[model samples]
Target: MTAPIALHGSNISYFTGKLENYFRVKGLDYTLHAMKFPGDGKRIERELGVYQMPVLQLADGRWMTDSTKIIQWFETEQPTPALIPANPAVAFICYLLEDYADEWLWRPAMHYRWYYDEGAHFAGRHLADEHLGSLPVPGALKRAFMRHRQRSGYTRGDGITADAVAGVEAIFLRLLEQLETIFRSRPFLLGERPTLADIGFSGPFFRHFALDPVPLEVIRQRAPAVLEWVARLWNTRASDCTGSEPDSVPTDLGPLLEAIGNEYLPYLNANVAAVAAGKKRFDADIGGVGYRGARYSRYRVWCLAELRRQFEVLPEAARADVQALLQQHGCWEPLWQEKLLPLLPGQDEGLPFRASTKMVGANETV
Candidate 1:
């Protein structure tokens, strides 16, 4: 008998939605332990050496955080209704798309959640305060929280303004347009069955954009097709991928992953760089105001860091595939020469800030 899997998470978290989808797709038996808004969730995460929701406690007592890591574990352990396409090319593409969702989409989503609406803004703050019991009182606590929030505040980029919001909105619209074009032909992003890419993108799509009242309305008005797709994906009842009983790999996925790498990923990478550069400029000029007021530099940095770490873990041949994709997308130069290289110029000891293609495995040091 296998030990039961336990999930510690919140209902409203987009990342949690990602994990839920994984459980459904893999047909894994698991139980969710919903934590109190900020308190219980934060406590468990801190003890486990992570700072986010959707943490997985395996039967063997091994704890995992981050949706990407959890998904990879599922792929290795379950290997059915394959989340990662069998073809190296397609699997790599799925990884890239997943990265985009986890990184790029987070900023705009956070911005809308905390900044656009007053009700949500206050509600989030109160929740945080309550979660941080004995930390401080209301007034001073709010100030401290704001300072901490500014460090990871999601924004269009380093500095966000009303104009920045508009710019990010345009990017979202463009992405929606592309997705609508593709989804019009196929039900899922990859094809008949949902792949890892679909699960990754859906997490944020459902949480911040679809469920949140303010952003939900925005998505409905601007991108009805995307909203529809979200509904279809979430409402799916199938236990596993077609033709796979317990665990079966999809056979025909090369074309889909190649298309993602060749056509979609470049666009996604450019968008991420633009947001990061723009936000950084915004913050430098405006000075640190508050989390609500400052640009979301730290969040962007964290996203990039995760990507770099993943890249390091790929096999050598696999790394080449990613590099080829990055080069074709025009990302190789800007990501290394312009943005990343300058960050850790003199530091050669730790992971340099610049992005590079390296193969890392499950046992490889990060």
Candidate 2:
């Protein structure tokens, strides 16, 4: 037996909830500790080289950051009850879904949490109590600061303008309808047991979509099955699941893949262009929404590069199958749109221990 790892982050944080779900499913022992500001900010930055939530302090005194990398590291260390499916093509599909869920769904998730008055008030109050209690500021003042910082960094400051708000929200609605169909037919995204795909999605659903007031109401009304899935995943343990690996991907997942192809990949391509051109902010028309001066992410540029790297390492047969699936869903062309990605030297090389950048670099203090 090992000592429980110290996980530090706000209880309501998006990435924190994601790491929690992954740890629960894997049956990994961990203790969740609040990331009190001022002190924790400096400590985490020193330990991990970036100020991000859900920093995992291992039993051996080593610290880890970034939920995706942490989960991958555990998957390597504890290979039984694999979170990634055994089928080669299915495994690649899991990576695709995870990436889509991580980077693309994040937009709508933040929009819902900060753009609406109900959601902002609810999350603001919770976060203020959870992380800002040590600031010695008035409770109301802390809540107001939380709201302003989030709205400035994530929603309005990131890209969701009045004209784009409706379109940005429609992304969530479409995802819910698609996921609602799949969850109604299966226990998890792939089959009877959870996979990386499900864990990836837990980033958004567990913290934002299922918990935020506005999106929670939307889920309760239209996608109750998805709501059930949220709780079901948290209660599930990977060691207890006896389901067989899927031989083929479900057809119902086509809608989600199509969305990744049509919307997310294109957005990545646009971000790539922006990074290559040395722009901090750029305008893009994605999913028919004109986003003016939206923040450009160097981290997201690495995400695109990482996805292609994942594809390149696939077995020959698996690569062929993945190519066909991605092509079928209109993902292939845009995925490889940039023949040469403009990446900095050794970007994100020291992941899980040290980070070169945050998801959104503009607002680090928040």
Highest TM-score model number: 2
Q: Lowest summed lDDT over 10 consecutive residues: which window, candidate 1?
A: 356-365
TM-score of 1: 0.67
What tens-digit string does per-residue lDDT give for candidate 1 at 134-253? Answer: 454575566456434632344432345665666555445656767766676666776767778888888778767777667777777777778888887776644544633212222333
lDDT winner among the candidates? 2
Candidates in order have lDDT scores of 0.56, 0.88
Task: Supply the global lDDT for candidate 2.
Answer: 0.88
Error of 1 at 37 (Å): 6.9
Q: Encode model 2's per-residue lDDT on 1-366: one tens digit a residue.
A: 257989999788778898899989988888999988889989998988888888989899999988878888888988877998888789888988998888888889999999889999999999898887878889999999999998888878877789998899899999999999999999999999999999999999998899898999999999999999999999999889888878789988999999998899999998889888999888899879888777888778888988998899999999999999999999999999998888888788788788875443432434
Runs with alpha carbons beyond 4 Å of true place in candidate 1: 1-4, 37-46, 118-152, 155-158, 237-240, 243-327, 335-366
The list of candidate 2 runs beyond 4 A from truth reads: 358-366
